[model samples]
Target: MSTLSFLLLFLSTFAFIAGGSAAKSWALSDNNWGLLVLTLALYSAGNLIMLRLVRDLGMGVALSLSGFVQLLAVNVVAFFIFGESIAPLHAAGLVLGIVAVALMTYPV
Candidate 1:
């Protein structure tokens, strides 16, 4: 991919994962409604950017790659930033998910 496309994809992925983190952190309804709304808005914006990036690429490749990017980003943030731990099984599951995405998206 070109540098611009790569940058756009990275930005889209970062925004989406960050928004999810915010939503998870502010799960309380009454107190965190504003946060939830903000996160949702960010997510919507990220999705729009992602859609444009995907259009520049292709749906099958873009979505399949994005699925893996989203999964890795969320897990990495959850583990390192949030001080969360995953069991070995979950790690294996993540690997399996990546493999699945690669398989499903491969130009056959």
Candidate 2:
């Protein structure tokens, strides 16, 4: 993958992860419409960037790669930022998921 594509995808995924965090905050708060709005806006921006990603890389590759990025990033954020933990068995499954994504996204 091109470095540009990787950077753009990372930016898009960061927006999505921020949106997810905003949504979680909204859920924890009481009637915080601002957080909800922010979530929607971030998601919209991420999707907008995704259009470019899909155009540069095909649909399958773009989404598959993005999914892989999201899988790793979201978990890291959830674990460290949100103080979440996964069971040992599930951690093994996460490793498997990483391998699966690596296989899917490997150069053909």
Cα RMSD to native, each candidate?
2.0, 1.3
Per-residue lDDT of model 1, residues 3-88, tens digit only: 87788888889889889888877874556877888899879988998888778888877887788788878888988888888799
List, residue by residue over 1-108, the lDDT tens digit for candidate 2.
Answer: 799898999999999999989988898899799999999999999999999999999999999899899999999988999888999999999999999998999987
TM-scores for every predicted model: 0.85, 0.91
| C-alpha local distance difference test of each model | 0.83, 0.93
Q: At residue 81, what lDDT does model 1 achieve?
A: 84
lDDT of 2 at 60: 92
The TM-score obtained by model 1 is 0.85
Inter-residue clash pairs, candidate 1: none
True-structure lDDT of candidate 2? 0.93
